[model samples]
Target chain A: MRIFGLRKNTMQEELKHNGLYSRSRQALLLLACFLLITFLASFCLGRYGVPLDELIKIILSKLFPIEQSWTSQMETVVFNIRLPRILMACLVGCCLSVAGVSYQGVFQNPMAAPDILGASSGAAFGAALAILNSASNRMITVSAFIFSLITVCIVYFIGQRAPGHRVVNLILAGIMVSSLFSAGTSYIKLVADPTNQLPEITYWLMGSLSGTRMSSIGFVIIPMLLGLIPLFLLRWQLNVLTLGDDEARTMGINTNLLRFVIIICSTLITAASVSVSGMIGWVGLVIPHLCRKIVGGNYKYLMPATIIVGATFLLIVDNFSRNLMATEIPIGILTAFIGAPFFIYLITRKEKML
Target chain B: MSLTTQNLSFSYGIHPVLSGLNFSVEPGQLVSVLGPNGVGKSTLFRCMLGLLSGYSGRIMLNGLEISSFSVRELAHRIAYIPQSHGQSFNYTVFDMVLMGTTHQFTPFASPKKRQIDAAQMALEQLGIESLSKKSFCCISGGEQQLVLIARALAQQASIFLMDEPTANLDYGNQSRVLDCVKQLSQNGYTILLSTHNPQHALFYSDTILALHGGTIAAFGVPDDVMDESLIRLLYGMEVEFMDAGKTRLIVPAQGRGDLCFVGSHR
Candidate 1:
């Protein structure tokens, strides 16, 4: 009843008026519970399997000392290995989903994602070049970050005409830029040392959190979190922006300025995520949409819910990647496998993704 | 505040759309910009609102240079309603109308209670408060236009600039919107509206600016701009005016080269 108090009343009112089953409250609660359960399942089951009871004990031991034989090794698995991976999954999930929501609003297109604007391809190319040059790990991430920023700047410069009427044109420009960078990546792969660089690049493209460490997570968390903060603060403005340029302008918004700020912020968050974790697609395209189906389109509710659902979805995927077979699978592969069918379902709905 | 554009010249790239266009409307005055299509009416309005730059002249709000005002300052002074805008997604009528309050509310804040009350009042002013919960895209063209007008009203600006306010409305709805415009004028709001229908201009507007090929061919009262030879030269059709008591009617002559009044005269 507490969970359903304000939200259920709003949903009932929305349903009475809109008549389209405004189950935003019900859907959000269900998603929250499912995400929590999934997160717990992710922690409990992995290649180095800790049973649910053991997992609970491990969690509790951090709070209160529990004398056990499995303490040291359990600490290593939970704190050293799994914690960083879970946190990385959470960071990437929040980055991608928030970026997706922002991109959709900026372009006024339901299907927009970070990759559409060449952020993923540019980061992949940067990392590939770094690997080819035998660069340091930090340099590789730095290069990816810079290149993603460059890609966004180029796309915005080419697509903008006059002011904030760049919705359709901007997406078209992003598609063109994305293809160009993808072609560059292919060329780099072709000429690279096949035994070492080619394999590394290929694996990076497939994406995995296997290599994620606390240090690497530290490198990404600060920048992505900083960039995400502004986005959360401006969520309502983003919603107002989706009403089209004229309406937004009429509302006394300097729409062009708002567009520029949002693009830079979301791009930074996206580029930082890709730099650390490699090319993880579909989470950006799919998670925010799934959240929208549950939380309605208001960013106040949608942003937090999308972050939670996305983190849970990816953490579960990361767990499956490690434990599904004898060899660790790439997170991207699992996402595509699951996302394709769900995306197909979304496409068949009355309002297909623009 | 009164709105005026003095010797306002605006061009898109090589071709000029409005040149040396001088016009004025006092506070509480309702003026119409009536001309054939592509006569630079919207361009003129855009220049006045500072939506378009690179113009070679001046637009003044209450005798203050429009160029001196920031976008927010201009928005607070004047509200513009576009001819017809596309809704790519579903937003409720209340949400749509509430957008006009963005000037007063920060991006971090939702509209306050007072703002919501103002929006509801604006909707009621247009007699469509019941439709506030409906999807904006689901409404009829006239209803959408009214909602748009309501949004402009919610801005609480003293001046209104509307492009083709009656284009999508039927006769009855057109009259209703015009009546709303009339009421706004009576309530001490200044209005500048663009329309293709000269009859609407004659009926609702005190001043008419006849635009021809990017320049003001004629300007003044409706009767003055609606002259016989000037209308023929501007629209390439013979036209005449007939006085019926207090009302003057604009009637286009039936055949070519026959600028004669065929209607009953008072």
Candidate 2:
């Protein structure tokens, strides 16, 4: 009976529906604390290696009048180099993961990820196109962001015009459009010089947070917020929206409009994150699933938990990517290497993944 | 307020699903829709719930047209109970029921104490409060149906539109769900339930609206409109009305000549 889902939750009724939920509240608090700790530790990492005490004092100097004892090199490493990259890593992870959860909710498909609507693929095409033309990194990011938005818009329009279940149509249209952009990227890569342009295009496609500057964050922050803020605000409607179209409509949701908003917001996050970080895999797909294990599957907890865990997951992965060897490993490769085995381990365990 | 549909007709291109249907369901009446497969019972419920907007007719909730009301206003007035099915994620029973009260709050806001209390009260009313913390997908089909009913109850709507509420349920669960629905009508809640069984309609419903080929076959109290001929017209089968004390049962007619033993089997 226990194995077959007949297990009765025996926690006292007075525990505020206590079994999974109260435990998740505690888990969320613990994860937040852990994220804070990791954030501090990341500031001290890298070849420059600022000591923990110096790191704390330097952080405190911003608030109170603490004497700056640390050298200018440490300051540069913390503020100029590590700070931007670390924040970029965390933000990109957070955005993509949240966008993944939103897409899954919107499409009601568990396999849905940040690129379900072709945002990342479209960004890739833009990045590849930029690299072929020998454009600057800033131009590549701009091109990627613009094309990503355009790709999702095209998918949405085609999805609406196509006949069938809207969710199925949208998903199929996403596949069609994503393949189209992916082919474009392939063509661009083929035409580029094998010496310089090819390597650059290939590396960008592999996804990295290397050379992340404050300006990179500056370019993407607005669209990311435009996406993340609305998703965070519309968290509750998520539960109803996942019930499919007619069910959601009868539940008093304007299913078309809600789907549109979720798609747009999630697309913004995906495009923004991919423009800077390239097509980072698994952070968006796996983080939400992991968060669902930690917290229950309710969107209220799952969404926020994904945000924290995503930031933490990518930050740690970036740490390993940068520090694991002399040459920086591509973060995308590290994610699949680390994420897939861990996910296999998770699924092999007793509890259900969904 | 009563729900009335006037010449409500809908089609998929030239393929008509429901056409020129007119019926009225009064307050606190348990109206069971009985039909054969593809008789547009589902389509009728869809039109009534204001889901199929392409339909050309007026569906009035009280005095106002259903189309004139906002989605929130319609939800406040009528709760829809879809058949229990699997979802991509496993939300808790409490979370499932809490979804019904979402119309009372904004999308940006989480469920507050008022919404929680309503959801709890609904579960309590259905006597399934103990299942609150359990995974919805883990529960039995019966319990899932009950949870959906509890969800509809939490919506605080006077009218309920259920689409094949017992489609995949076992006989025991089907009766249990129908009994609960019967109790709701007795407690002064209006309910529109669609089912395949004429016996369930006769025993549990106050009125029966039978549909055939996208049109009304019969619409009235079961006592006045239900019989063997009507069943024959609807299902194209010979059935007899067998008396079972107070409630009559629809049984297949005995002694079919084709089914007679003509072969060598002793």
Interface CA RMSD of each prediction in angstroms: 4.3, 2.9
Tell how far residue A231 is off in model 2, in angstroms: 0.2
Query: Which one wins on DockQ?
Result: 2
Candidate 2 chain A has its poorest 10 consecutive residues by lDDT at A5-14
Q: What does candidate 1's lDDT look like per residue over A175-276, in tens digits?
A: 899899999999999999999889988988888888678999888888888889888888777777897776577567788899988998899999999998
**What are the C-alpha RMSDs, in order, of all predicted structures?**
6.1, 4.9
CA shift at A105, candidate 2, in angstroms? 0.7
Cα lDDT tens digits, model 2, B205-264, are 999999988889899999899998889998888989888998998888987766656783
Worst 10 residues of 1 chain A by lDDT: A13-22
True contacts kept of 1: 0.38
Candidate 1, B20-66: lDDT as tens digits: 87778899988888678888888887777777778887788888998
Local accuracy of candidate 2 as per-residue lDDT tens digits, A129-191:
988888998999999999999999999999999987888988999999999999999999889
